[model samples]
Target: MKSTLKDPEPLLETQWPADPVKPRKAGWGGLKRRLAPYGFVSPTVILMFVLMLVPIVMVIGYSFMNNVIMTKHPKFVGLDNYVTILTDSVFHTALANTLAFTFASVAAHIVLGLLFAMLLNSPLLGTRFKALFRAVYVLPWLFTVAIIAVLWRLLLDPNGVINFLLMNAGIIDSKIEWLSSPGTALFAVTFINIWAGYPFYMVSILAGLQGIPKDLYEAATVDGANNFQRFLHVTLPQLKPIIISMAMLDLIWTSQQFALIWMTTGGGPINVTEMLSTYTYKLAFSQYQFSLASAAAVVILLLSMILAFFYIRHQKARD
Candidate 1:
């Protein structure tokens, strides 16, 4: 009889209506959904504009003004800086050296890299030694440019290891001043750069070589192709794209190479090894001609863009 009627509190709780769900503000929700992606991307965009674009724009503007260290207020100079750079024999020499250094280093990189890669990829080599060989070859590249310059400077010194070995080997009767001689300075720097840079090409080309389908080589062999023939007909074609891309990248990197040249040679022996990058630094900091240096930098920027554009066009054409 006591439990026949439910308790009043329990009955009241059961009879109370569930709370209603509030309707979403459809406009605000849709707006947020649309903006979420851009909100995430905004930080990167702002940073690039501030850091990269702003500096480039400022440099370009400064190139047209007399923004030297001596001037409190920069005056507009128009094309005077450009005219001076164009007419300067030193600048011309720098430009030529830059071109020579870039081309020679890249060429050597390709040859040495390809040779090492091919040797490493050969089926004749033991599989156990392949990784070790790659690591050993790549050790030079792991060192900083400054370290490499210092090491090479010592090695190329008149009485250093290189001369000691050469004299002991009966190759030379005298110690050669490799960095102090204009004739040998550029070549020595270029050689050191090539040694440091070839590993990049080796790794790149090795990757490309490994990516080539085994089936292609098998099919070529089935058609009575020898190793050289198969490599000529199949390997070279497959590697062309990778080679072009890597060469272009190397060209850009080599053109901008400064620290090694700066530390090792200082463009010495009458500016024989002065590249555009080193020349620009010498002008800006050492000579304190900021406006002219800006002009030189602009020229370098334009040349780099032009080269990149042509490379892209060539790649697209091949595609």
Candidate 2:
């Protein structure tokens, strides 16, 4: 027989000592470690379930019904409501407008937020002024959306400061109705949202930016990396998680925006600025098209779910 190496006397046998797992604690010791995190989080879970989960479940149940207003009778119509509302012209209009508003707002939020955060992060800016500017930026968000909408509506009105200034400058002979016209109403609402909403994204992103080590940038500099290159490599990688989270949060907020539209345009002169939220309200309350409105709610809920799903998947994939 060819003297094959004896496999080093079977290293598996040499190395296979007892693969001992530590003993499990009998009770409280194990429980304390496992329960500590849940104990800390339990209040939030209870609150969310009571406030958010219950409401969402109720909404979903109502979405499948044609409810009588006076009697509170919910007749299950299955998918008919969905099909009918989905095919409705006004629903289509609201869908398009809502999407346009959401996309524009979210895009502007991420881009402008990043830009503002970058500026705020700079050593070129004075910290004192930065604090002042940040405070001012946050003021719009501090106000209720309804209040903000009313403020902007007045500012954008014919006799509002905007038109007053323009007319004073002889910019136009006629006063334009910023919230009244079909062309300008939706776009005007979008601008207000962008202005009010961007600060939150900026602040959150700035916080994320702060978490990144200054050493990373220093190392990049040592490697002859330029500002742009360093940002593209180091800053962006650090910001990816925050950006995804911020984008999802913003999408949900922008999609559900109701008070602004209600206060500013009331869904417009001819259903021009009517987003899905306003449209759903009009259907349910105004027209008593309960089933149809429920269907619209379902659509909104589904869209939000899709956004949240993608956000979570993106986060998981990153991990």
Candidate 3:
């Protein structure tokens, strides 16, 4: 056994150095991932900047200058344009008319829309009847502004069907100049706007009604609440947010309405139906007072922004 044994070799000791840590260099792939969101949104941002922001800035600059867009060298006039617009009697009249039109239209729209929506939502009505009424009520919303304007103009003409019917019914002694008379032009336009806009309110309210919880109504019924009581307490409470939001939006839109009035009354009849929109247009294109128009536009923008602020706050509060 001893003669067959062989000697073992000793093990060698080795010390290996740690590999150097490499700093990560971001590749094109990593960079692309980081920038992909911005790249996707850049077009929209650029488009808004060019179309909206640029125009707004230009208008603001024009508001502070004299003879803007009409003269070779426009002079800075500070707040003179604003002062002139604010003090102008015509501007005051336009403002008053705009307020009257907007408030009346929004109020009537809500009242009529709520009434129609309630009728449509009634369980007593058959589905076929509901569908028919819904279609008829919403027909106005499907027409373009131009079409609506033209249709209303024809209908409100002095010798038109409306006058004929009114006269035959003994409601009027003579044909009324609905759009031509100063006293009636504002009323006529307001009525037309209300007719055209109420369908939007009706649709929105109908949706809101459908979404209301049945349990609330059931509970109200269990509490011995009458139909009117339930509607006042339950239905109105549920639709409050929707109604408020719609009213504000309608106010903004109705305040800016130009096409309908322009096509119907042309802000005529001694400017009785003149709105801020028409007033600004006249200052710019008709009177060649670009600075005054810009100032007026800025005022309108400010008013709209105020409305938007309230709207956004309400939405956030609702959320």
Q: Which candidate is the best by TM-score?
A: 3
User: In candidate 1, what are the lDDT values of residues 1-319, reduced to their tens digit?
Assistant: 5678765763444567879999887798899999999999999999999999999999898889986657998899999999988898999999999999999999999989988988899888898798789889989989998889889989999989999999999999999999999889999999999999999999889998999999999999999999999989999999988888889888988999988898999988899999999999999999999999999999999999988997888789988
TM-score for candidate 1, please give it: 0.89
* Model 2, span 1-319: residue lDDT tens: 8997665654454556788899876799887998999999999999999998997787777767776453376677787777888888988898899889999999999998999888888888798988887887767778888788878978998889999999989998889998998888888999999998998888998998889999999999999999999999999999988898888878888889898888888998799998899999998899887667767888888989998888889879878
How far in Å is the alpha carbon of 129 misplaced in model 1? 2.5
Q: How far is each candidate from the true structure, as Cα RMSD in Å?
A: 7.1, 10.3, 3.5
In order, the Cα lDDT scores of the candidates are 0.91, 0.86, 0.95
| Backbone clashes, each candidate | 0, 0, 0
Ranking by lDDT: 3, 1, 2
Instruction: State every prediction's TM-score relative to the real structure.
Output: 0.89, 0.80, 0.92
Model 3 has an lDDT value of: 0.95
Displacement of residue 227 (Cα, Å) in model 3 is: 0.7
